[model samples]
Structure formats: C-alpha cells, structure tokens
Target: MELTPEYYDKGEYIETDTGNKVSRKSVIHGSQNIILGGKTIIQTGTVVRGDLRRSGTAHAVVIAIGKYALLASRSVVRPPSKVYKSIFSYYPIKIGDFVHIGEGSIVEAAQIGSYVQIGKNCVIGRFAIIKDCTKILDNTVIAPNCIVPSFSVYGGSPGALIEELPECWSQVMEKNAKIYYSMFTPK
Candidate 1:
C-alpha cells in the first residue's frame, strides 16, 4: 500500500537537549509502532514500533545507524520484514556508517556495511549482507541471505559478483580498520 507523501503531515520538530530533530508531521507514535512517513525525520536515540503496514506479514523494528550516519531525506527504514512488491514494503533494515541508500529502494533483513552505496530501487532481500565499500547499481535485486564480499560491485538480480571496484582495495585507514573510511583504505 503506497501512501502518498501528503498523507503524512509535517509538524514542528522533535527537539531535545542534544540535537535530535524529529519532524512533528512524522509518525513518532501510534497504536503499535511509531510509524514514520514522508517529511518524517527521526533522529538519534529515537525508537518507533507499532507493527504498522498491511502486508499480512511479520515485521520487526530495530535501532540502527552509526553515531554519525545520516538517513537521507525520504528514506524509510523500520524493522526487518519482506517487501512483496515495489508498491510498498519495508523491513528489518540496518544501515551502517557512511552509507548512501539511493531512491525508492526496498530492503528486508539486510545489513548494509559502511561506505556502501546502494543505487536507486534496489530490492535487497532478507539475509543479505552488503559488505563494505560495495556499489550496487540501480534496480538490482540482491536475493535473501546473500553474502557479498567487501569492495565488490553488484549489478544484477540474483546478483553477479565482479571485480569493478574503486581504489580502496589496497589502502588502509589508521583508526578504524574494519570499514572503508578513507579512499586509500582497502576493503
């Protein structure tokens, strides 16, 4: 069920002592979970759950995002649940640090690593592991539970593993070694 952007009204702002700015128009509280819609800007330390949506499916909400991770405008993330169609679906989603999830992509039970760029309209299924520094092009379907190695470029449904990566494969970062922080760091 695709709800139009206008359905969600933007309110003042959920401000706090720190700097978490949650949009008033967004769904921060409900009968079950705190449902967020367009114009909804949830900040750090915020948690929402009501098991909203009409999927006849099970959904699980999780607290995600790194200390400095920014969930871009119009990005919808909730708990892990299977999105049956492109029309409307959100799931257990864990977006890592410095990740860029492009437009209108649907995800379920997916763990996107740091520095990962999932292009527009990606169908990342349950149990999918998008490793660090990987660039998934537009309209790709990463099947359920797929384990992608770090620094790879995937561009097809059922996914095709190739070696077309940026130059972060051989370099190293001094402080954080697990993620691809600097351009010189290897995956």
Candidate 2:
C-alpha cells in the first residue's frame, strides 16, 4: 500500500517516551494549561486553545486529553465557555482515553468520556457531556448542555441519539486507536 506524504512526514512532531506524538504545526496555546496522557496523537493543523482560563483562576487547566487519544488533522479542541449571571468563564475540556476526534471538527465540550469516536466536521457545543463508548457520526452539530449517554450513536444537527452501540464498543475503539498510534514514525 502506498502511503501519503502525511504518513511519512518526518521532523514535524515531538514524540515523547510514552508514544505521544504532537505535531509541530499544531497550535497549542498556553501549553502549561494542557495536560496530555500517554500515546496521544495531535496531528498537523490541530489547534488546542488553553489561553481561555476560568474565572478567578489564574492557573486553571483548559484541556485534559487522556491516554491513547487521537486529535486528527485540522481539528480544534477548545474549552467550553458560558456566561453565568453576568460572569463569563471557560470550562475545561476533559477527553477520556481511546477517544478519536476526526478532522476539521470543533470540540467545545466540558467532558467526553472514554472510547468515544467523533466524526469529521462535527461541532460539539459548550457544556455537552458525552458519556463512554459513544460514536458521533460525521457533520453532527451537538447543542450546548446536551448529555449523551453511554453506548449510543449520536448524529445530525442538535445531535440526537440515533442508535445503540455494541457492548464491545470500548474494545473496538481501543484496538483501532492503538493501531493508529503505532503507525506514526519519528521524524
């Protein structure tokens, strides 16, 4: 099989000992506010905004991505923001292990649980809490404060629950994410 230039793209990322590959081209604002677990891949053109801090907290974390998580190319992962009683604040984005966020998607959710698969061009709104083992189909627009349950497939504008996931969904996500993480080579 012929691989694309992206696959062979060397010297464009910083690979840690735990196999976390973060692209040099990706924009990570306030790196101190971002915590990445092991084996996480942040692809080229991905933007992680951590400069938006919470109210009254100078050193608050903005994005906490879990182990074996993959942030695909051109995706933007930002903390969710809201106005509370005339006060504006940004909440942390907590993504669990084995999560795959597809290309061009914008994630502004408060929490995304383990084994979640978010497809391309999706919009995860502010304060949306996505439970474990959920699959979000392509082009879906999840509204603010939506609580997505576990083992379900969510899609479409406003993000309705479309179907139920199989019991082994977590295993499947783990397998695929591991494979993807292993495919990256050191530049």
RMSD of 1: 10.7
Per residue, candidate 1 scores C-alpha lDDT tens digits across 39-158 of: 223433333444544456444344355432333334455455554656555544556655555556655535877667667777777768888777778888888888777878898877
Which residue runs does candidate 1 get wrong by more than 4 Å?
A: 1-61, 81-93, 167-187
Best by TM-score: 2
Q: Give the TM-score of candidate 2.
A: 0.93
RMSD value for candidate 2 = 2.5
Report the Cα lDDT for residue 139, model 1: 84
Q: Write the per-residue lDDT of candidate 2 for residues 127-169, one digit (tens) a residue.
A: 9999999999999999989999999999999899899999999
Question: Which residue runs does candidate 2 get wrong by more than 4 Å?
Answer: 1-6, 55-58
